[model samples]
Structures are given as C-alpha cells and as structure tokens.
Target: MESFADLSHFLRSHRLRTAPAETGVSTGAGPRTAPCLLPAELARAAGLDADRYADIEDGRAGRVSLSVLHALASALHLDADDRAELFRLGASPGTSRLRGLGHLTRAVPMLPVIAFNHRYDITGWNLPGQALLAWDLDWPVEHVQPNLARMLFLGRATRALYGNGNAHGQRQVAGLVGALRRAVEQHPDEELTRLVVELAAGSREFAELWARPAEERSDEDDCGVLFRFEHPAVGLMELSRVVLEEGAQNGEWAVVFSPEPGSASAAALDDLLARVSGRPC
Candidate 1:
C-alpha cells in the first residue's frame, strides 16, 4: 500500500527533526554527536531492537503492532494529530478509536476558535470565530460548507483578510500551498485532487505556486503564524494563530487566535467576545 511509504516518510521526517539531546539517547562509547537521531538511536529510545525498527522504517515490516507503534510515537514526541496519523498509517488503516471531538471548540468562548481537517474543511467554529472572521457558520441549504483553502483562493473577501502582495502574503500563500500538497499526499482522493485542479485553473497565483517544486516551497506556518487580521469591528489586530491537533483521528486541527495580554488587540478581543457572549454559535 502507498500508506507504507507515507508512514516511512512521516516517521523519517519526525525522526530527523528529533535530536539526541531531546531523547537523551547516549551515543555509545564513541565521541560521535550527530544532530538528529539515528535509526538505531531511535530504536534504542523506543526500547526496540535495532533490526525491528530498521525493518519498520524501511517498510519491510507488515502490520506493525499497536504497542510498537505507541512506543515509536512516544519516542518521536508526536502530538495528538501526529500520533493519530501514526496510528492510522501504522497500526490500523481504517480503524480509529478517536473521532468527533470538534465540540471542544465551543468550550473556549473567549477566543475565536476554528476546527478544520487536513482537507481544509472548516468543520466547526464558535460564535467568536464566526464574528471574528465575519463568516456565517451556518450556511444556507444551497450554500457550500466553509473551507479555508477555497476561501483563501476563491473568495475575494477572505483573500483580503490575509497579507497582501508582499513577503508576508507570499509566505502565507506558500504555506497553504505546501499544506495542501501534503494533505493530498497523505490522503489521496478525488475531492482533494479536484480542489487542486480547480484552484490551479481559477487562481493564477495558486497555479504559479503549485507549479513550484515541493522542495523549493517552505511551510513556515506548520505550527502557527503571526496573523494580522483586519477585523471589521475591532479594526487592525495582530493575533498569534496557534494551531493544535484536536483529539481526533480525522486529522482535525484546532486553530486558536491569541493576542498579547494587556494589548489593545487583547482588549478589543475581550470587547468582541463580550458582545458575542450568550449568542448562538
């Protein structure tokens, strides 16, 4: 299956990002200090034999055990989403014990919260989020559901919310492009492919960026981005966009906006939340 190669890539990428210092894996008697963890080092950290880990990484192992997958996930310091993805790619292909936790977004009423999947489909949002983005969370019967990529590329108003034709804008667009490509790589489907084709045909900027080699593009917003939003009500406010993996196996991401404490942005956010308090989501 292609998932095997995807799993191998995912594990290798995470392993490369993890350092020996982080894992506390000793480099034996030799005075060799490599930057990233070696395959054997990762195996030792996960309490697995070197050969077993090597087989897994090389895609020679068939149907890895859950215990081993958990061990590797723990050793790799994977977050909720990464852990979920690991389990999906390693232990079980279609079986998922965790799902449908998007309601957690409503728990944080003070900040604008949006929940989306790898497909960029906006699954859930709180009233503050709806108000913050001026997005009608409740689409009409004839209207389509909200999607981040579609809004960014297709909707003029949503495009205006991001950075304009500058470095910041370029970074934002390139990040989205990288993210979309990664999403398609992980989960190949007609819908996702159709979205890419549609964007390439409709958006010249998207087409240009999408045409660029994957190695040439940088995904700077993998964790989050310092988003400067032009809120219609609060005016210009700089909020740190924090992206956390929601506790679900559906590849959901919880995107939260936080402003510096005691700043004008924070005060404006407070006022905005207060105004929307007790309102329908």
Candidate 2:
C-alpha cells in the first residue's frame, strides 16, 4: 500500500505527458487545447470504461490486474523503464520486493552481481557482471531483461560459457528449475507461470527437467555450485557460485561469483574488473 499510493500520481503524470495525437484522441474545443490527453481520452485508448479508469487514476481501485497495467502502459506509449515503474507502482500488496537493483549492484564493488526476483528475471547487474557475462550494457532500455532459465537453456553465449558444454549447462538449468519449482509452489505467481510455460515450449531440455520428480532432481549444490566458464575474454575461469537471499519473503536473491585467492581465476577476475573500470591490472 505504501508504494501503491503513488500509482494515482504516476498515472496522472503519464497521462498528462501523453499527446492527444499519440492516442488518436482529438482535443475537444472547450478550452482543452493543452497537448495532454484527457482522462476520458486515455481511458478510451486503454480500453477501460471511463469510470474504471477514473477510479484507477484516483487511487480508488484497490487492486489493478497486470493485464490492465499492461494495457495502460501500451496506451500511454511508455518505454521500458516507465513500463517497469508502472508495474512497480501497480503491484499488489505483499508483492513489493528488493532494494533498488542498481543500488544493490553498487553495494558490492569489484564483484560481479546478478540479482533477480522469485521469477528469475534479471533485474540488474554491475560492471563486473556485464564484463564477465558479456551482457551488452549498450542495449536499448526497451530490450527485455534476460531471464536466467532462458539464458541457460536457450542462449548460445551462455551455453558456450559453460566449460563442459551441454552437460554443465543442463546441470545449471536443473538447479534453476529446482529453485523455480520451490518458488512456484510457494508463491503461485503469474510471471513465474509464464516463464515456465515459455521455457517449456522453447527448450526440450527445460521441459524434461521440469517433468522430473523433485526427489530425483540434483539441486543440492545450488547454494554453492562450482562453475567453470570458458570466457572469451579471459579464457578458462573457475568460480564458486553463491546465492544470497535478499528478502526472506520476497524470494529475491543475488548470485555472486567468487574465485579462490591466488588462483588463475582470481587473476582473470582482476583483469575483468580492470577492463570494466579502465584501470590497469
């Protein structure tokens, strides 16, 4: 409710920013000549009844569905960042989770940090994470954030990064599926369901993993799985993977990779950091 309080203001501001021509709504002649679209015009564009839209815009709607939020975002012509913020503002109670993603990455300098919610949607990564993972920081903000399971099962770069190829990748995905199973059972989230459905449809490996019994899955090493990456920039590197839970109830966690001190992997990581920071190693 604390965050939801801002939803009205957010919607109003965006609606004000929306041009009449953008949504194809003509500015009526009764002194409404400002570039902004009227509430009724926005409601028509968003396909909601005028009263319903007014309730939502007035903070009187107790809970708005994701579908409605998506509609509003599309009608407003919001870009990715604004869309993300719209969802955050419209999120139902008990769904508010995680510190600011960028802040979390900045909290730990020189370390590669990848954080996600219960749904495993990649929220943010720091410089080291971008350098090590070859994540294109230059990508347009509208680009969808990478999902972990999707990366493991469908991404060529991620597959190539796995030192042992498919075998290692499958193991990693099995671990992810195992965690997802727990999250799905506990939360019954819509985004998580969509992710599972998408991956199962796209990747045979993910479908097979998801089909297996929980007892038969081998995700016991999820806490600290040892990963070896054949990084294009740094060659072979070994790091211990640690999952740090950010919020106990939110199912948010940060994946951190740390190398043993005085090892080749450590040197490789240092070089990566230097490259990212523009400092000589």
Q: Candidates' lDDT values, in order?
A: 0.69, 0.71
Q: How many backbone clashes can be found in candidate 2?
A: 0
Candidate 2 structure, TM-score to reference: 0.60
Any residue pairs clashing in model 1, and if so which? Answer: none
For candidate 2, write residues 49-71 as lDDT tens digits.
99999999888897787678867
Model 2 spans > 4 angstroms off: 1-96, 100-104, 136-142, 164-168, 216-222, 277-281
Error of 1 at 279 (Å): 6.8
Query: Across residues 15-125, which tens digit of lDDT does each residue of candidate 1 receive?
Result: 999988778888778787577899999999999999999998998897777678868877887643455456556734322322332334435656776666667765445
TM-score of each: 0.57, 0.60
User: Where does the lowest 10-residue lDDT sum fall in candidate 1?
Assistant: 136-145
